[model samples]
Target: MKKVITLTLPGELIFTRLAAQTAASVAALVCGECHPKDNNCEFINAFELAVSEAFTNSALHACQDELPPVTLTFIAERHQLTVTVRDTNEPFGIETPQPDIESYPEGGYGLLIIRKVMDTVTYRRDGDANIISMSKKL
Candidate 1:
């Protein structure tokens, strides 16, 4: 059996904590016995970071008019947990090259961090919505 949680938050940077915390909770639930409150385990930290980055990226780049809403959907399976962040933003290439490390760029590391933390990362334009889905094995 799979468990799913869906949350829609205001498209703003301040709300990233809500989204990230929600992700962490879901991860803890999926982890079954290894809760972060008791012990550090599984991909709770990674999921939280990836969700925070995704929510922040969408809030910064997506809202063109009035503030929109970013929807986070978490699907927890027997052996995996997948999170999809949905936004009404313009499409962008998912395979963007990693930023150079020597120059020490200040930004441009959101996708890189997400890719490194999650087992799989993907982006796609779904009609009028853009979706970034990240999955990690349990």
Candidate 2:
């Protein structure tokens, strides 16, 4: 059987702390899933970073208005961590990066980091919610 753990945090700055917490949570769960094996430090660190970026992205771009609420969920399995961040904000897509890697600005690197840390990144619209899904493999 597959095990699932769900967490719902408010659409506020405080939830930023939860990013690290969620990372550790996923790490532990992944450890359990892969018991008798060493902890996957790289996978855990990447998941944590991706989760932090996704949460910060929602806080910065999505919940700008006095909207309802934002939520983040993590689904961990044997060798993967799938995260879904839901928000009720304007659906915006990531802008294309500069062709010249060196020409890229110092900022606007959040998605870059997320893409590097996550094996897959996807965005979708569910009703009034914009859902961002990021996954990392162990």
Candidate 3:
């Protein structure tokens, strides 16, 4: 069986935490439904972190004016989970940079952390939407 959840929110910094929490809550519910016997703490943590980063990035970098809407979709299977975040902002190129952890930069670590936590991370522009897709294996 496959489960899916979708959430839409305003693309504003103020809504970033709400978006992240919504995604995390749905992910936890789907994970529990898929694997009722075992407590997948690590998987849940990684999914939450990756989804939060993606939501934060979209909220921060994707809105131009009027605060467009951002859409988040979570799909869960028995052994895999996929998250897709869509925004109406201009398509920004995705460049994975390896930031030196020792330097301790103030920002620019969201994508890095997302890539490290998720099993697969991808970004692309589709029509007028910027889409970020992330997946994790249980």
Candidate 4:
């Protein structure tokens, strides 16, 4: 069976924790359905981290003045989970240069971490909305 979950949140840093928790909860449900026995699955952690990073990036970089609305959609299948985050703010391209880990920069590692953890990551502009889609195999 396939399950779909959707969440709409304010595009503000204050709601980042809420976004993370929501993603984690859905990920846990999906992981449990996919892997019945293993409670401490790594996929849950990866999903939480990737979703949180995406949410934070949208909240910080996408909005200008009043925060917009961020939409998160999760599609859970038998063996894979796909997440899409959409924001109405200006579409800032996601082509960020790989940050040098050796330097340990204080910021700019969100995209890097997201790409590293998620099996597939993509960004596109749909009219006025910026959509980031990430997928991971469970």
Per-model TM against the reference: 0.93, 0.80, 0.86, 0.89
Which digits, one per residue and each the tens of the lDDT, describe model 2 over residues 25-73?
6665675543222346666667667778777777776455563466777
lDDT of 4 by residue, 1-138 (tens): 888888999899888888877777777787775442344667877877888999998898754777888999999999988999999887777789998889988888888899998999999999999999999997
Task: Tell me the lDDT of candidate 1.
Answer: 0.89
lDDT of each prediction vs. the true structure? 0.89, 0.71, 0.79, 0.85
The residue-level lDDT of candidate 4 at 137 comes to 90
Q: Give lDDT tens digits, candidate 3, residues 18-63.
A: 7766656666676664442234666766777787788778777764
List model 1 lDDT by residue over 1-138, tens digit each. Answer: 988889998898889998988888888888877675544664888888999999999999865577788999999999999999999887777787899999999988989999999999989899989999999998
Pick by lDDT: 1 or 3, better one = 1
Which consecutive 10 residues in model 4 have the weakest lDDT in total?
32-41
Ranking by TM-score: 1, 4, 3, 2
Scored by Cα lDDT, where does model 2 land? 0.71
TM-score of 2: 0.80
Q: Is candidate 3 or candidate 4 better by lDDT?
A: 4
**CA lDDT, candidate 2, residue 43:** 68
User: Which pairs of residues collide in candidate 1?
Assistant: none
**Count of clashing pairs, candidate 2:** 0
Which residue pairs in candidate 2 collide? none
Report how far residue 28 has shifted in candidate 2, in Å.
3.0
Over 4 Å off in model 4, which ranges?
33-40, 62-64
